[model samples]
Target: MIANLLTIAGTDPTGGAGIQADLKTFSALGTYGMSVVTGLVAQNTRGVREIHPVPAAFVAAQLDAVFDDVRVDAVKIGMLGTPDVTRAVAGVLAARRPPYVVLDPVMVAKSGDRLLAADAVRELREVLLPLVDLVTPNLPEAADLLGVPEAVDEDGMREQLADLVRLGPAVLLKGGHLTGPECPDLLAMDATGEPVRLTAPRIPTRNTHGTGCTLSSAIAALRPQRSGWPDAVADAKRYLSGALAAADRLNVGSGHGPVHHFSDWW
Candidate 1:
């Protein structure tokens, strides 16, 4: 059966990040895509200008509307701008638990703008993190969740992973922010097993706008079809790498542009 994947996130007018990016990823990966908008963002590859959040009650209504009818195989959650919105999403997920849930802790944009508020970070960590199956956070986001400085090296990343998994979900800690030729990602869970490490050579490109959103959504789209989390994450990484490699083929914007979500097809 084709996986029915849902994305709960904000909007990107440029179709490079947030709900737009998530939907594109779902379709590209051979899944039926659905969306529940939490906020409307006015931005492009260059930067974010304005944000208008949907009401918390309305956000719950949207989730209810979907769950009442559709069989959501998996869900990918991104940019919930406020604490109220965060709690709203968590409330529904706790009630009607999906088969798989992937949380992309989208705190900052590729253009260096803040997408999530400071107080909402606490709400995400407390209410949402425990409810999801997996949480994907980059270097700075990991530090923010743990209330510590960003990890500078692999050792630091390993140390932080130990603490993060204690928060009640498996973590995919991305090491792209570290200055190195290779971009490594670690999958850590509470099970008594060694964490899986996957690394790929960093693709040289300025157009990496919606990488976080794309990767997390790809995992959600693939998880229902894959045997386990490790395989799903590995496949998702390969997909993102292809998109990044083909990113330069398209002319999108002046600043950090988007990866080619349909690189394999067109």
Candidate 2:
């Protein structure tokens, strides 16, 4: 059966990030996509001007509407803007227990705008982290979660990953923020020979608005089809690299635009 993917995130009217990017990613990967908007942002590629969060009860209703009929094979969660919203999501996921879940710790935007609330971080750690199959966080996010100085180099990243893996589920430490010619993301799993390193040559581009959203969504899309976590991570990396390489093709916003979701297609 074809996989059905759901994105529980905020709405980005620009279509570069959030629910829009996630649905586009699911379609590009040949999976059926659905979405539940948790918040509405007022801004474009430049930066987030304002965020209007949905009521937690309404968010629960939306999840019930989706799960009542559709059999969600995988779920990609992003940008739960408040502590109440996080708790709502946690309740639903705990009850349904979807087969695969990828949590992208979307604290800050590519434009350096904060998405997740400061006080809500604790809720995300205590409520959501343990429920997910995998949690993907950038260097800054890892530091924020672990309450440490940011990871600067390869050594710093390794040290942070060691502490991050104990937080909850398996961890994927993103190396994009780290200055390097090659972008390497580390996956820390419980299996033997853990901490598999996945690397790709850096694609120089300013149009990387939604790279994180797209990567995590692609991982969720491929999870049901791939053999295991490593394979899914590898495939997601390749997909994201292609999208990044072709990002310039899309002349969307003046600032950081989106990666080409249909790079492999038309």
Candidate 3:
């Protein structure tokens, strides 16, 4: 059966990130996509100007509406603006227990705007991390979650990965933030004997607005079709790279633009 993937995230009217990006990714990978909006963001590729959060109760209602009708094969959770919203999402996931859950710890936007609130970090780490199959965090987000300095090198990345795994989810520690020609992502889980390392040549591009959202959502879309996380992650990485490599082909906004979701087709 084709996978039904749900993205619980905020909105990006520019179609570069959040719910729009997630749905596009799901479709690009040949999966059915659904969404629950957590915040209404008024912005574009340039920057986020204003954010209007959805109430916690309504967030729960939206989740229920999806779970009640569809058989969700996997879920990709992005920006939850506040702690209460985080708890609401966690509560529903705890009750529903979807087969696969991927958390992209979306703390800051590519434009450097903060998407998640400061206090919400605690709730996400304490309540949400444990329930997910995998938690994908960039260097800064990993540091924020662990309450430590951002990893500057491979050693720091490994050190933080160890600390994060104890928090109760397999971690896909992205090394894109590190200043290097090549970007490496580490996937470490308790059951998986050794951590798998996947590296790609860093594609130089200013159009990387929703790279995180795209990668995580792509993993969720492919997980049900693939046998395991490693394969899904590897394939997702390839997709993101292609999207990044082809990003310049599209004319979007002025600032950091979005990667092409349909890079392979159009």
Candidate 4:
């Protein structure tokens, strides 16, 4: 069956991040993409200037409309900007029980804009983590979730992954920011005998505007149809690496340009 994937996130008019990137990833991977916008962000490759969160009830309404009509093979959740929105999502997912769910705890932007509210962190931890199949967080986001100042090295990443997996669902700790010639991501889960390490040579590019969204969405799109989480993650990494390598082809915004979603097409 063709996978019909959904992304619950904010909007980005620049087509670089948020819902835009998620949808692009799903399509690029041969999945039908659907979306429910939780917030509208005024942003570009340079930075996020402002964000107007959708009302909690309206967010719920969007979820209802989508879930009521479609068979969502997998779901990817990004920037839930408020506590109420987070609760709404958790409740809805609990009711529908989609085949797979990938949560990207998008706390901050590449340009350093705070995408998640400080207070909403508690709600996300309490309500959403248990429901997700996997939680993909970068080093900084893993640190924030674990209440640590930072997760700097391989040891730190493993420690954070162990702590996070206890909250339920597998954890994918992205090491993109860790200093090295290669970027290694750790996938930790009880089902797996040991933590699986995924590594890729660092792609040198300033146009990596929507890497997180792309990676999470790619995994979500692959999960149901792919063999297993580890395999899905590895495939997602390959896709993201290709997109990053081809980013220069798309002459996007002046600052950090977006990874070329349709890189394979051209």
lDDT of 3 at 184: 90
Which one wins by TM-score: 1 or 4?
1
Count steric clashes of candidate 2.
0
For model 1, which pairs clash? none
Instruction: Write one digit per residue (lDDT tens) for candidate 4, span 97-174.
Output: 999999999999999999999999988887999999999999999888878878889998887888888888899999
How does model 2 score by TM-score? 0.98
Candidate 1 matches the true fold with a TM-score of 0.99
Off by over 4 Å in 3: none
Tens-place lDDT digits, model 1, residues 161-201: 98899999999999999888999999986745678999988
Candidate models: Cα lDDT each: 0.95, 0.93, 0.95, 0.93
Cα lDDT for residue 206, model 1?
Answer: 94
- Candidate 2 — which residues are off by over 4 angstroms? 191-193
Worst 10 residues of 3 by lDDT: 188-197
TM-score of each: 0.99, 0.98, 0.98, 0.98
Q: Roughly what TM-score does model 4 have, to 2 decimal places?
A: 0.98
Q: RMSD (Cα, Å) of candidate 3?
A: 1.0
- What are the runs in model 4 whose C-alpha is more than 4 Å off? none
In model 4, the Cα lDDT at residue 145 comes to 85
